[model samples]
Target: MSIPVITLGAVASAFVPGLEQLRGPVTVVRRCEELAELVAACQTGLARAAIIAPGAADLTASLVDRLRFTGVVIIALRDHPPGAADPVVDGIDYVEASVEPAVLAAAVSRAVGRFEAESARPRDSHAYADPLGLPDVMVPQPPDATEEPGTGRIVAVWGPSGAPGRTTVALNMAAELAAAGSSVLLVDADTYGASVGASLGLLDESAGLAQACRIADQGRFDGAALGRIAVSVAVKGGRLRVLTGITRPDGWPELRPAALGKVLEAGRSLAEVTVIDRGFCLEADEELSFDTLAPRRNGAALRCLEAADTVLAIGAADTIGVPRLVKALAELDDAVPTATPRVVFNKVRAAAVGRAPETQLREAWERFGPSVRISAFLPMDHAAADRALLAGTALLETAPASPLRLAIAALADVPAAGDTRRRRPGQRPRNVKFPGIPARLPR
Candidate 1:
């Protein structure tokens, strides 16, 4: 039996791509506003399916919810998706140019065949819904209940190999921003190992990334749920919302690229400044053949980098560290072709490198021709950092006078309290400022 044909009511120019893959009868309609006309057309009883672009201006939660008429299967087309390009929605089948048209035709044929499958096997709701008996399908509500351009600053702190203190810098940077009275969210996207919880002295027994993936999987992550999962740590006068990493490496696969991207996107929506704690850019070997226990997709961190407005690359100040930083710069160049990372030299205590660590890094990076700007230089102060970690406190609270803390503070002070400035293309950055060292930022 031939699969009944569907008419496509797409926002202008969007229907061409799917037509290549969809062999069924396709009627290219105009804008989202014409959905009503399309529905009226369906009343003629010729079309059994509708191909609608979710990006269409007329498409809305209300609109989709109303599309429950019998014998009509509504398929929403999105150009790109939550992770990769597999566009099959929970209820709708996706037809695209790349895949065999037969695959989609078969899917639609299955739906038509299954009109009686629900009644034939009348399973309880529990069979379809999750174990908790919640609704099986929970599509994400648009942020603010309306679609608008996002407004937030996301600074991703990434470094090269050899533990160049990416976490430390991220922690203090978030703290300093919060101290200056900016609402900040610190995300631990380090899929290899997440130390943000430990670094901040947070017990964080609750699900962080794992739960986030679950929520995102349902596509129902909202602003309120985002707040509930974020572990709060006291910064200067403000608070730091920390999203810790996955507890075990085995769960890494669950952190799908799209889900992680959604979490970050949602986080940015709620924060004045979002600081990300990323894993080593050089360590892509999260995938180990022998270790089924540890599947290193590294998807979470990479997604963060790709979505980042600014990336802060950390490098150790020592000879070995400098060379590694040089190479790490190369890797980031390839991995994130779209992003321009701000390079910072951490633990620059040795006078042997030069009096000015920033100048040295600038010189080295310039030779590579990537044009990296040295943003900040944090001196090495192991004693203070160790003491803070042991006490489960931040260096700002544990050792206010430490040179390392001061450097981080100075670097962090560049952005004004609640500055909300969007980064422009090809903008040059200057040193971050600190009015003066205080007893501490108000808690």
Candidate 2:
């Protein structure tokens, strides 16, 4: 079968000479003003490929977004000058770097062939927004959870060393928010000891964030590509879109800082709340020693802090734990000066454990006052936590009534769910980046 081809509202002078060699049915428009009409006509499903001039002033990002929705291949003129007015975004399949007639035709043929193969297969909801303009496929946003157009929310969960329950807190918090009918995305941003997949019993097979970094290095990442990379977790009573961590610490280099920022931003667009499970250490160096995974430039965890609107500081409830948290709190101040850390003492057992844990924490904070906001307290329930972990489920699902789970759920303040555009004092703008060059390039 032959493929359908299209000309923009006006044919470029550069492409006119070789128009006859283009082997497809063509529809041409008179001028740039009619480009919309051409695009609209293409939506009737005839155009499989679009041939526009590099100098075509009518092309636009929105137009490309629309054509992309229709699953059409965009073939720009090969002779496009280096600084053409209309630059191609990353999603474009092939670019004819030269204006040769045969080369352009070959590129178009390849692009159309790939598009047809994709169209022949089942639809991929994650790769594209549904035809009817429905919410995103993998992580649909709740109708009431709308942001102020382009703004997004960020949530960060941090814990001191010694199994202070960061993942547990982040997972349950995200699940609770999702259950309340808000679209939530849970991200495991911990560079070291990223056990989100293991805690939930997900197979640690693919490197999701690595793939995203590769895409972002090419400057092509968007909401649609994000949905494709994020792994969807099916919670019993809740829905969560998760972007799991790298399988091994060595894989951290693949998770570029800029790409990670963009991925979080994209998650914010698709989800009402983005819950991040961060590494305990906020320092941006790989030399620090850790238990689970080796470091990759060591900036992954700290990057989460810089991006988060609210930072949840978690710590153990025992004697040594309190002092460690106090010290950790001091480090947090230096790392994220713009945001104050909120403290949560996990594994608190007032009955079986000593009553003095809270008192000690309060006293220590009095001397170290104003730096940390000691907020919630979670009691210890070792039996329930162990059972839930063994069953490959969260405490909320395995032991909903457990004191620890209840405490974590209560930490969900109204502001976290109500406000979607809040930002910390020091977070970088959405388009800016920290000091460093990107490490990976797109394949």
Cα displacement (angstroms), candidate 2, residue 169, comes to: 0.7
Best by TM-score: 2
Off by over 4 Å in 1: 1-149, 282-296, 351-362, 366-369, 414-443
Candidate 2 — what's its lDDT? 0.62
Tens digits of per-residue lDDT, candidate 2, 249-359, equal 566666656667877777667676788988777666654242112344457666777888777788887776777888888887887777656777777765533565566
TM-score to true structure, per model: 0.58, 0.60
Please give the TM-score that candidate 1 achieves against the real structure.
Answer: 0.58
Residue-level lDDT tens digits of model 1 in 1-443? 34444444443234445644664534333333465566655434445555665554354444433332223556555455345654344456544523444454555566645632331221121111122233321121222311333466788889876899999988888887777787788888887778887776665544466566545543556545565566566543566777777668465665666767887777766676778888884445454443322443665667888888878888898778877877878888887788787677787764647766656655766775356766667777889888777756566666766667767776675433322334476342233222322222211
Best by lDDT: 2
